[model samples]
Target: MRAVRFHEHGGPDVLRVDEIDKPEISAHEILVEVAGAGVNPVDTYIREGATQPFTLPMIPGIDVGGTVAAVGDGVSGFDIGDPVYGTGIGKNHYGGYAEYVTVPDDRLVQLPEGVDPMVAGAAGVVSGTAWRALIDHGNLQAADTCLIHGGSGGVGHAAVQIAAASGANVITTAAPTYHDALTDLGADVVLDYGRSDLADAVRDAAGGGVDVILDHRLHEYLQFDADVANVGCRVLGIGENETGVGFERSSATRRKDLQLTMMTMFNTPDLRVPLRKLAYLMSEGDLEISIAETYGLEDAAKAQQHVIEESFLGKVVIVP
Candidate 1:
């Protein structure tokens, strides 16, 4: 089996494709013949030594979609040849940047009928994160006006659709080029963050301020988010700045009595439920996963570099 391994943290240069032994599954785990692996910013951070507590020769990826190749003892409700998709490895074991991956039975969901494996892999982490942030934590409702920062990116895009499907008014920030596409994805309004004051734009779009905010660029947009949130609004911060930057004190949030929360997708103990919900949405055509690009398994280095270079819509997948 071939896998991407980083013996030392640095840049994309640290990733190398090497032939490694296939992962052996424990009694509670299952072996998957990986079809696709999703790449994310955290993978790059781990590669660059930005995220810590990882050992050398680590395999870097969490989301994977594949077919069950073998099942370990005590694994029930799933069998060989079942199509499954969800977060894999990465947390405490080797991850999905490989030909085969060992995954705990609890973390995966059976792919819904007619769902593509690539799309499932792409939806794995981002969709689950969006589900938790907007529905579980933010408590978004039908009457709420929601502003999603970086709406064209992976999690943001998913948030837009999820919010819209729940009957909330969805506002999002993106480049002008993606505005129309995002609108089609359920964003009621799209603000060009590069050209306009996001706070003002959001306020104008929502007729004063929004009821909820899904913030992906925390440090870059936190104050602006606070400025444009309605009184007692909820703001969910999804991404963290790498530099540990601080925000200036402001009376906007204080005066409004806003509720702000920061969330890491991994903080959610289990992804099985969220992934199943997202899978149902995908299967029903109520939601769609955007895959920006796909690369060969051996091109993990290039894929990670692509994620670091610029903001792209949706996810980048590595097909094994």
Candidate 2:
């Protein structure tokens, strides 16, 4: 089997495709013939040594969409040739950037009929993160006014769709070019994040402030988030880390009784919880998965570079 492995983290160039022994599954795992794998920001973080990966000589991928070639003895409800998709790859274990990868059965979800495997791969982390932030953390209601930052990116795009489907009035930020496309995806208002008065723009659109904010670009918009949150608003942080940014936490806390949620899927150990709901939504066409680019499995390095340098509109996938 061929796999992408990085012995030491530095840059995209560190990734190399090499012949490796096929992974042997544990009793509760499944062997998947890799079809597609999603690339995310954390993939780069691990590659660049920004985050401490569980192991070295690592295959860096978190989500996959593929056919089950075989299942371990302890695995049931899934069998040979079943199409499935889910997360739990490349996190202290082998991932989908190869000819074959082993995954725990619990982390895999059966794909719905007619859902593209590439789309399923893209939905794993980004869509699940969006679902966690808005529905799980924010507790968004139908009449809520919600602001989604970085709306044209992977998680942001999913956030827009989810908020709109829940009947919330959706406001999003992106480059001016993506405004029309975002509106088509159910955003009630799209604001250019480059604007100096973005807080005012959000306020104007949502009648003075919004009830929930999904802030992907946390450092760039933390203060603005504070300004635009309505009374008792929920502010969920997805991408940014708190150590880099400093703001007046007391004011937001005292003034609006805001609830701040900083999240990563790793914070919750169970991948199955979000995967079930996300799979159902994808099956029903209630959620959309966007693929910004697809590269051959051997081009994993190039794929990682694209994720870092490009302001791509959605997930970048590696098709093995």
Candidate 3:
């Protein structure tokens, strides 16, 4: 099997394509023949040795969509040739950036009918993260007014749709170029994130303050979120600055009694639960995975670069 592996942590240039033996499955694992793999910003962080400690020569892909080539003896409810997609592949083990990779049975969800492999591959992390942020952590409800930052990005896009489908008044911030698309995706209000009066805009849109806030750039938006959140609001933070910058709790944050939750998809105890729901949403057309770009396995380095440095509306996928 051909795989893209980085022997050392650095820039995307460190990723290289190599012919490697296919991974073997454990009793609780399933061997997936890779069809598409999603490249995420965290992949770049992992490649640069910025996150948790990882071994060298790692394959840096987290989301995968592929077919079950072989099933573990202990794994039930799956068989060879079944389409599957999920995350947690590249974090601690050999990941999806190869022709074949081993994934835990519980981490692999059956791809719903009519979902394309590329979209399924891209949907895993973003959709699951969005579901966790908006539905689980933020506790968004139909009567709530939800504000989502970076609504044109991967998780942002998914979060907007999820918030809308939940019947919440979805207020999202994105570039003006994406406002129409986001509105079509169920965002009730689309504000320009670059606007100087973004907080005021959000307050106006939500009729004073939003009930829930989903933020990816906490460092940039923490105080802004506090300013625009309704009393007792829930704010979910999924990403932040890699520079280890600190934020101060503002008076509004304290006075309003905001509930702040920082989350990572890996921290989820049962990934299959949220993954199953996201798959169902995809199947029902309530959720859509937008592919910003697709690259061959050999161009994994470029894919990583595009994911981190480039500004794109959705996920970048690797087709092996």
Candidate 4:
């Protein structure tokens, strides 16, 4: 099998496609013939040795969509020809950047009818993360006003649709170029993050304050989030600056008794549940996964670079 592996962590240049042996499955693992693998910002970080330690010569994809090529003896409810997609493929194991990857049976979900493998692969991480952040951790409700930062990225775009489908008044921040697209995705209000009065704009959009905030760049937006958060609001922190930046808790955050929770999709004990729900949403056309670009498996380096250095409104996928 051909796989993209980085022997050492540094930059996208470190990723190289090489012919490798196929991974064997454990009793509870299933072997997937990779059709599409989603490239995330975290993949870049992992390649740069920024995240937790990993085995050298690592495959860096976290999300995968493909068919079951082989199943372990203990694996059930999946067959050799079933289409599947899910996350956790790259974090704890070699990942999905190869022609074949061994994934735990529990981590793979049957692709809902009519959902494309590439779409499923691209949505695995972002959709699951958005669902967990807004629905599970944030407890966003239909009556709530939700504010999502970086609403043009992979997770941001998914969050916009998820929040909107949940009936929340979705207020998102993105560049002017993405405003109309975000609104089409169910964002009730889309503001330019570059606006000097972003906080005020958010407050006005949400009618004084927002009930929930999904923030990825907390170091840059923590104070701003506090400024526009409603009393007893929930702030779900999905990411932060990698530079060891510090942020002060604003007086409004304390005064409003807001709840601040930092989360990573990897922490979810059961991904299949949310993924199943997202799958239903996708099948029903309530959720849409946009593919910003697709690259061949050999161009994994370019895919990783585009994920970090480029500004795109969806996921970058690798077709193996």
Candidate 5:
């Protein structure tokens, strides 16, 4: 199979397209012929050495949309011709960046009706993460005011729509350039991320501190989590910049009573349920996907470059 590989990591130029052996399947796995692969911030992070401990010559895509070309011996409920889409947990395995890739049958979901291949692959990861934050972790209610960081980006836009549809007034942070776009995605108020006094602006727009906040960048906002959280409110967000694996500052977080949401969509047992729910929303028009930009499979370099160049509004795709 022809696929892109990077033996040594540095920049997008390290990615090289060449023929590699197709992945071998285990008894409970399925092989997909790639239709589209979703490019994420993590893809670039891994490529650029920011996130590592990875094996060299890695293919860094996590989400893929395609049809089952072959099924392993013990697999059931899925046929060779069925359309499928899934996100591979990139902890140790090869991912969805080639003409063929293998995944455990349990991790795959039937591609939802009324959706295209690109949309299915694109929406899988962040949509699941956003839903896990708002619906599962935050315990958001109809009257709640929920604030989301990175409002114009992939996860933020999904959270904005879901929270608003669930009846919460959603406040979000975004660059001034994205205010109009964020509002169209159901953000009740869009605060400038460059400003430090957004709490005051949020108070002016809504009555008080928010009942919940879904965070993406936590290092800069770690102290502010309590300042804006309503007393007893759930601060369900991830602080990925802890400088190490396990989050530090346990005493402070405990003092705040923060319900820090640790979302790992790939490891859980019941992913398909939430994944199906996400597709239903998209098909019914309650959810919308924003594509910052797209590139062909051979143009993977440019796609990764764009992610480094700008903090974008939504997920990017590489169509093979």
Candidate 6:
């Protein structure tokens, strides 16, 4: 099997493609033929040594969607040729950058009928985060108002749709160029995050302040999040760490009785939770997944570069 691995971490140039041994499955794991894999900021973080440390050689990617080439012992209700998707690939283990990868059955979710693998690969991270944030952490209610940053991006678009589907009035931030797209996704308010004063703008759209704030860009918008949050409202942040402002305990703990949630779509025991809901939602037309673009497995460098540049709106995928 060919996989992307880097011996040293520094820049995108470190990514190297090489022939690697196919992963062997544990008793509870499944072997998936890699049809598509999603690129996320954490992929770059792992690749660049900004997040967790790994062995000298590593393949970096987050999620995979493909047919099960085979199932391991003790794994039931799943068989060969079944389509599935899930996270935790490149984080604690080897990920989907290879032609084939092994995944724990608990982390794998069968793809819904008609859900494309590439789109699932693209939707994997964002949709899972949206579910954990809005439905699980934020305690979203139909009458509540919420805001999401980077609305046209992967999680942002999914958050908008999920919140709206849950009956929450959703406001989102995007480059002005993506306003129409956000609106079409059911965003009641869409603000330009590239401009200054995101808090004031989102606040005005919500008619005062929002009950929940879902932010993908934490550092630049932390203080702004504090400003726009309604009293007693919760603020959920996904992925951003180590920088920006207001992340300090003193500042983040300041009044409005705020609840700050750090969101992760992986490392959960109940992997079936979001997968089942995402399946039902996708089938019911209540949730949507979007792909910004696709790259080949060998183009991993460009994909990493794209993450650093933040030039893409949604997940960038590598199709095998």
Worst 10 residues of 1 by lDDT: 243-252
- Candidate 5 residue lDDT tens string, 1-320: 97777788788899878788888889988998888778877787777877662588887687877888889999988888777877754435676767888877766778767777677777777888788778887898997999888788778888999998899988898999999998998888899988977877876666877788887777666557666766667876554566644335556556556666656555556767777788788878888878777777688898877766777888788777
Clashing pairs in 6: 142-167
Best by lDDT: 4
Candidate 3 at 296: error in angstroms? 0.5
**Candidate 4, poorest ten consecutive residues by summed lDDT:** 243-252
Model 2 agreement with the true structure over 1-320: per-residue lDDT tens digits? 98988999898889999898888889999998888999988888888888767898898898899899989999988979888898867877777888888999878988878888767987888888888889988999998999999999988998999899899999999999889989988899999999988878899999988899998777877777878888899999886655676465656556877788988876656788888888888888878887889998779989988988888787799998
The candidate, 1 or 3, that scores higher on lDDT is 3
The residue pairs that clash in candidate 4, if any, are: none
Question: Model 5, residue 73: what's the lDDT?
Answer: 96
Q: Which stretches of candidate 3 lie over 4 Å from their true place?
A: 52-54, 242-249
Error of 4 at 258 (Å): 0.6
Off by over 4 Å in 4: 242-249
| Alpha-carbon lDDT, every model | 0.84, 0.86, 0.87, 0.89, 0.77, 0.81
Q: What is the TM-score of each candidate against the true structure?
A: 0.96, 0.96, 0.97, 0.97, 0.89, 0.92
Q: What is candidate 6's CA lDDT for residue 238?
A: 85
Q: lDDT: which is higher, 1 or 4?
A: 4
lDDT at residue 86 of model 4 (Cα atoms): 85
Rank candidates by lDDT, best first.
4, 3, 2, 1, 6, 5
Scored against the true structure, residue 62 in model 2 reaches a CA lDDT of 89
Task: Judging by lDDT, tell me the better candidate of 1 and 2.
Answer: 2
Better of 1 and 5 by lDDT: 1
| Predicted structure 6: lDDT | 0.81
Report the number of backbone clashes for model 3. 0
Between candidates 1 and 3, name the one with more favorable TM-score: 3
